[model samples]
Target: MKYYLLALWMWSGIHLANAQQAAVKVLTRAQENRILVRWGVDQPLEWQRANNSGFILKRITIKRNDQLLASPEKKQLVRLPIKPEPVESWMNLVQQDHYAAIIAQAIYGESFEVEDTGEQSEVSRIVNMVDEMHQRHSFGLFAADMSFQGSIKAGWGYIDTEVVKGEEYIYQVAVANDASIASGAGIAGLNDFEPLPEVVDFMALPDDRKVMFSWGIIPYKGIYSSYMIERATDGRNFTAISKTPIVDINDKTGNASTAMYFADTLSNNDQKYQYRIYGISAFGERGAISKPISTQGVASVSTPPRIHDYEFKTDGSVLLFWEYPKDAEAEIQSFEVAVAAKDQGDYKIVGKQLTVSKREFSYSKLEASNYFKVYAVGENNQKIASQSVLVQPIDSVPPAIPQGFKGQIDSLGVVQLSWKANAESDLLGYRIIRGQDKDEDFIELYDKAYPQTHFTDTLSLKLSNKKVYYRIAAEDFRHNISDFSEVLIIDKPDVIPPSAPVFSNYELANSAVQLEWINSTSDDLNLTVIKRRKKEDVNWETIASFTDLTTVFWDRKVEKNQVYEYLVMARDEANLWSNPNNSQITIAVFDWSAVEVIKDLQALVDREKRVISLFWRSVAKGETIAKIEIYKNKKGEAPTLWKVIHAGQNALNDVDLDINTEYQYYFVPTLHSNTPAKAISLTVQY
Candidate 1:
């Protein structure tokens, strides 16, 4: 009887509460995203009013339609609606005004509307949920006169009822600890039969990279069980990287399918792999899984040492050196060395087979004038060579190059000729000759000269157009001449850019507008990101700019529905904005849900100097009292922008004053918007 009465009270509250308020409203309004009953009130009722102060609205109650959904304290269900606001967030809420208001929600959520449930085994909890969703902000605990139990079948001492519902086992047993619960004034925690699973192979490594598993445990009896693999990249996200369990031992010995595996790669670059197993009896009972076993992967080097030096000594022996004071891979043997001089000189042999593991090397008698080099070789044979060091010995002179003489002359445009210089002082630089006409006898192109390398011509200038041609020759000094280089040419292109893109007018919605356009041309090399800003908008605006070659765009926000102007363009890698695609479109700007509340909807407000009045309305069934929050500030105290009016009661909506006085206001209906309860926000502005 106690439970029955409570159920009835809750039911009545749902059907009668909101219906009473719906009868008083006079205005019909729709917000851009909300539905309104009338000119939405802006001023929250003064909290001192009878409804908000000393008086408390009577707790509304309703009758339950069925025996289900009659629990008194369902913590889980209630916790859902009571969002877990952080302590600071909750404190901030209460501290905002004198106190925070608790707004009500729709009467039990809409009754369950579901498809047919065939005789097949299926549980229907929808009906139960709908009836229980009312005042969803809180959950209850007491199970009704009937057993509001979970799916578990038979228990240690519970008895089953008749008329079985498919696989569902209807069991009910009197509370053995009713006395214990009454004394504590709390519900009893569930107590079931014994034997939870036992840990078989439990083990954890010193590092946090630990794996948990169970094998050979009581609950797990080799009928082919399951396991998990957890890994951490930074040693923080210990994510379960495996979907299947590890297969360490086969149930059927040789017949066991290949076991899937898991390696938890840890931050230290070490991988700890664990294996565990579980099983279920043919009759449906389950055994504990065996404990887990862990193994680690081989250690590895994440970095290497820095080499800083290398030098050489005299005596034909090349010295090899390095700087790896901390290198653990030091058991290095045999030092290999090679030498070369000048950019064009071929590399020569110089290093000894071994350097007795010395950091410095000593080299002796050989071509003392040549450059020398030293490189270190690792056990793995990997090597690092030092920069070649050019050395001058006590006895050396410039190698010889046949000097004087040369050949040919021509004037493709200017002239052509040849010559030579000393072969080797470590032979470098070249010389070219030029003549006005064939065999005209020439002069050196460079007044200066060297050995080898000769010819040059004006063939390019004689070609006309934008093309310029020329040719080069190789020189080896000492009067040695090689073949000339291939002829060369360069040119400049002549092309132009295309026209600008064309865009459509702005389409309004919410606080933004939509804009679209056409690509500039066939070679629309790049689709520049779209840009926008309000008319007279100072800075360049960009709602969404994409670099990908996209021709279509939708600029989300334009200044409300007001007129906004925009230009569009395209550019190539050359960063050339195409001609501007211009458009001046005007859109309507209004908060639809912002109800234009008449000072006195139908009543009168008369004063000697002006008139101002209050309007009233009623709420509907299931509709909630959003905020009647009121706000007021002196003109100099606030910006022209919308400012929230805070100090007021939750139900207070209307405010009346002298019409000549400047005042701004609006109301926020509980309904954020007309879209849907869970959709768009509806604000009832006055």
Candidate 2:
């Protein structure tokens, strides 16, 4: 029986046992002379047992004159355990109170089961028996709660007429056979009873042939478990509209609802009605009634307007016609036409309010894209709108051609183009066309029309074309194309470097280096540059630049016997340099200082021996000499080293020679100094 009751409590979403741990739950209401106490068992089995075995009531004085009593005094309220009145004794009370009859039937009925037509399954039979028992237990408790007299008759209530003034007492109730007790405290004698607060924030909302009523529940949930609603056509006289008190069933479902609501249907529209509410406590006590709230029911506009036809005029205006039910027309107070620029955009009323007799309206203002709808506004201020219809003006003419089209290409091949925007109101955007040549067919640069006045494009620098062309055309909302604007020609950036100059010949004489080169063949060549650097130097210095077609340059700033590397490059108007590898040359300047060192050098030719003897003076003061070298060469030929002499020697003989040949002998001395040196030469005929 305990398990069955627990299952039933869980299924019904009742939190009686979980919220109150005691087997019996008690409540108390204080009065001037008497205190009313109510008690009930949380478990159905316990309640059934208590009903058979009766319950014991006890009281304790805890405080006097607001002062605590250190040792509480206890007393038994009844000498004998209190039990339910006999079934025969309830006959008179049952005739007076319906809830008393319900309690009587629940306790004294022969069988609590519903009459069954036919049943054979054991499971079905058991389930029906359980359901019947749960129904009896729940209905009996509910009935006892709704009637104070019923609770007393059921032995769940007590009236203490012996309460003392200015004293607080704690009451306890327990099943006669159980040790567990439920307790509650109340003050007696002192007027502790105050009027209950009226239903809070009570409101009524009138709708089409219906009214919804709601009131704050959280503020009064502890004071009232249910409510009774009353209504009246005239504000003076009111009567209960509900057959029974309305309980908030959502409390069992664990709904945290702040307000309780009740909806009532009206017999007719536009009729005034007044409503008020009364709160019913768990102890079957009705609280103070709420203030009356009044409103009138309004008729509903349910029929939507339907746009059957529309026409576009030559003046760029539109006319719309709609249909509505004749029977529903009486419910409508006015009509309206609405329009939006886009299909899903917010719509606004287009013209002044239209009467119910009007079925057509002319819309003078129009946009490129328009969605129109008709609405029927009822007397209740509710509006029902029709399906939106797309409307477009009749237009065959395109927008004017775009003008002032121009652009420039950067060195990175990025092109920026812009044009004057078309002034036409219906102009959607512009289309750009591009081509490598004026004669070839142009291709669209973008998949869709551009809505801006300016555009940018990147070109491949690897292409051979020097110039690209672009053209723009205006387009309207109806996809009409205008004539193409003037073709815009833009030059591609010059990224290719100029051809490098070639070194034709070079000479080393008079302690100076002279260089010659062939100029670059590119037509856009801007300058010819000459650069020179010592063979050991990491950086090159520019020595000369010529804007003209000059090919020869003499570098007189050179030192004797120094090896210098020269580069001749060409630069174009775009400031691009030529390749340095193809235009570089290395030369050694003549050592004129060596000629000063060996001013007295001489060479004698002996025709019989076929040899040339060379002599020179060495080492001046502050100069160190490493060795002397003899170089012999036939006239008009480059010299070759003949012999290396010791540092102490200043002369050498070249024996390998041809007779009658005008030979030149060079006397070069290797010096261990930072000063420049050159080889001195003398001509000898052998």
Candidate 3:
């Protein structure tokens, strides 16, 4: 009988184990100091099908230190009222103590189902369509009203209880079927999860002798909490400035409708201030602070001084002067100077901060990009800046006055000046100056500064037999002129003279010697003088004088068989004489003797042959015969007309004389130049 009873009890325990919901989760509400319990079954449809009945909840508590309090014996059970809708807020419990443990239970039927309406209703069809669209199983309107009998399912649940401040508590929970069969118990202590709300919209505004701050309040959701304000000189790195948190009413109004205000007293008015506010919970938990805000105390601000004049040198030096307003509001403590290469480039400080009383500044040996600006600082530490100044260094020192100055004049009276180039990096140009005399003041040779070291004075064309002095000076890019260079004296050249006349040809006549010569080629020649001397004479006599262009000369006084020497000299307009250096031409004048009469002369004619022949002997001294003339005429006509036919020949033959006609021929011999010889006429018949 005992074995039978044990078997029956084991079967019932197995049945209860097969029909149970998941264990419940318990949470403590930090916003309300209340306990909230929630539980759900993993297979609600299967549980309803098996039990066909609703769940029952059970809760109980045990206080370890409060033994005088009546401890609940047999867990207090409460039947969950059947409702048409499923419950999300399974349970809510309030407890007086700030500390306690909670336990809970849920019992439900193993099988149950909602009664189905046995008709095709529009509401049912709509509900089914909605379920399909959502991809979820349809739950009947009366599904929560279903209950279970005999307790087919069982599972643990939870009840939240507030815990005493700084105290600890433990709790246990279990669930049983309608047959009183129980599951394992769950245990936990009260836990708080809610955190304090963050303070919103914290700000700092500048005010005289103080910095005012305001922030949005977070309505007390749990216990009464307060706000703590913090401050920092820099934007970051803050410390609590308000020793106590500013309190607010814990009423139901939202923090959005209210804002908390505070002022951090200032020891001085010259520094920047940053602020933030934090929400402190009643439990001493501090939420995150609001985002930081910064401000500067009120003070008069002024515009920076203006730079009125500035200069830059090629040697990397800068000079600057400025002017500032003298009004009382423009009071300035100091001035700051900075330089940069470009508009947006990082600027480096020029030097130590300067007093406002000093209106001028200078810098030297700066060798980078040159943009600059100055800032005026007020007593409140606020700064205003001036317009940027571009520092472009200019070359000031004139070049080492162009060394090695020299001038030259050409044969055409052109003056040329040359000198060494200036070594200055910024030398702009050179100037050439000229003076008529070495000691006189020089005038500019050119209308403008000469761009090169060499200068040709085109306007100094009258530089004949006169001295001209020249000097050079240099100017820099900034028009800094240098002193004149060493003097360069150039004397007009007199090197050119009339060219010597060349003897081209000579001819001797009876009473005179004819001479022809090439004219002197010098353009400046003034006159030509012809001189003559006999071989026996010791001195030369002037034969003729002619102008500079004359080329020919005549010497009418001459004797035969005499050797005479002749030469020509030329003079220029400068009174310079041509040096012959013994250059001269000599010639001998002579007369040729007359030729003698012809000897052994004969003439013959052949009528049938139509030929005629003549013969004669030449003069014994052939050198004395310059030429012979032969003349021919009709036998009777030529004797009167007497034309010469042949000369200097010993024989002559004439042919084709008219048939049966007689011809006469005259032969004459002439001396070299003096006279012709007697003529002989010959008659021939053919």
Candidate 4:
């Protein structure tokens, strides 16, 4: 019969042309007397062209007596081109071999095209014609694979009886008088022969009334194109179950499987049957048969056991009870009980070989927590288990108290606590309680128990408490509570900073600034820092720091006429600083020695000229005056420097003075010593 020729197209060790080219494929097998050769075209168009033109066979003897022949001998097997026999000749072979009939029909059929139903579009007609040509090519090649004699008659295969022992020959086949068409070649010799290996990994799975068989396919893909299965009841005499060779068609698609499978229905259950398999090569040769495997079908279990109840005795033992149908007792060989410490843990068989009549089992070795299941074994050793049931022994003793207690509180008032977990298998969880003091009542942190060994608690840092306490207790599944663990004491972090000191008063004496302030009211005050900076300065420089309760500071290092800003900040033991907004003050140092330098200043207003004449007396002692400056201001306005006067002149005329307005005039001197000089003023009206 015709096969699909699926995986057989990908023949191993065959040198094929490029995928873009019309490639021809060839395969060879060596026997004791002769070598067999087969050739085919991969493309449908090439296959049709080859059939119409027939083929020419050529042989070249490349080696003789295991030695290379320098001058090879070439010969043409037939003077005329080889073509398929006439349709009349195929009639005799078609009556005996269905594969021969398939080939004859594919080549010389009445209608070589698919009949168009109703869709007459050009694209549909083209697609149908291409599909029909591919179908013809595939069936013709697949039928040739079934019969060696038919393949030779179809001009696709040949046998070389002229091959000599220890002589290698290369054979080539191509369409007659057409060198452009693709050609195929193969190398074989009488000595190039080895026995094929048996089929590998043959397996059988028996079911109620059917048996599934499978074997490894990928490993033997190059050696065998198909397989044949046989079965027997007596294990000695075997009968072929497959009328034709079985080809793996599933491998034609993507993601091919590595194994091939077949299923056989049995006449009755519980009857032993032996099975074996054979590998068939592309050249119609069968390899060694597989070793026989025996199996018997078995009836499937209708229902599994059900666990109803369980009881815990006072002696620390557990008794489990289950139920099964009484009428199906004969189908059960025995029963087994499995147990595990946890629901999802690995379970082990606890009771083995239990009689079918027994519905209850007593387990003497019981754990604190256990999950149990019962399984019923069938006559064929098939086991069906029941749904698992949890059984915790009657636990009166609670778990051990949590150990290794430790805790810490951060500056943000977040507390973290951790301890060693309890070792009891039945422990449910832990409970944590917190208190601000040892004598105060503790409060539960969570409504339900915490499931982990670590816990976190957020406390209010605004409270007046300085210490916090934590304790943990472990509980079991039976609600048995353990004693509280050791108390964990953690001092609360100092988030409250000390209050700033206020500057009450300050005095300048002898060019020294004396500052007095009230100290911070916080009890944890560590130090007071005094920082000073000029009015135009960007950063402050710490002038002094005091750890004691000193509210007075003498800033003796002072400069005249330079404005200075001071900031007093109080710091606590936690290195937190107080706000400086209420404690900052600015002061300007006055030069007392320069105040008397410009004395006896006078101003005269001339109404007729609309001008004011000013004059000052210069002592010219202890310092030389580089220049003098005159200042003028109205009665309620700020003063402005009116004019600058030369050192020797020491007089200035202010013009355009406001009439009927009282004005003030001041005189200042710029000394060569760079000392600041105070201004002396006189009031005048025009």
Best-fitting candidate, scored by lDDT: 4
Worst 10 residues of 4 by lDDT: 3-12
The alpha-carbon RMSD values of the candidates against the true structure, listed in the order shown, are 44.7, 13.4, 30.1, 13.1
Work out candidate 4's RMSD over C-alphas: 13.1
- Candidate 2 residue-wise lDDT, 83-144, digit = tens: 99998898889878777776777677765543333422342344465655565666677676
TM-score for each model: 0.21, 0.48, 0.30, 0.59
- In candidate 2, position 220 carries an lDDT of 83
TM-score for candidate 1, residues paired by index: 0.21
Question: What's the lDDT for candidate 1?
Answer: 0.35
Residue 304 shift from truth in candidate 2, angstroms: 2.8
Quick one: best TM-score, which candidate?
4
Q: Give candidate 2 misplaced runs (Cα > 4 Å).
A: 1-22, 113-130, 180-191, 310-321, 324-330, 333-375, 381-686
lDDT of 3: 0.55
lDDT of 2 at 208: 83
Q: Write the per-residue lDDT of candidate 4 for residues 1-686, one digit (tens) a residue.
A: 22222122221223222346665677888998989998877667777788788888899899999898999999988788888888778878888876676667667775444334442334335435556676567656766666777788888889989889989998988888776677888899999887877986899988778888999898887688778889999999998775667766555434477999888889889789999999888787888999999997887666789999988777778889999999988877899999988788998999999999999999988777789999998855778889999887666998888899898878799888888888987778888998889889898897776889888899898886767888889988777889998788898888877888989899887789999999998888889999999999989999999999999999988898889999999998889899999999999886746545777778877888898887778876777788777777898899998778777776677786678999987777788876766667788887
Deviation from native of the Cα of residue 231 in model 4, angstroms: 4.1
Error of 4 at 85 (Å): 13
lDDT of each: 0.35, 0.78, 0.55, 0.80
Better of 3 and 4 by TM-score: 4
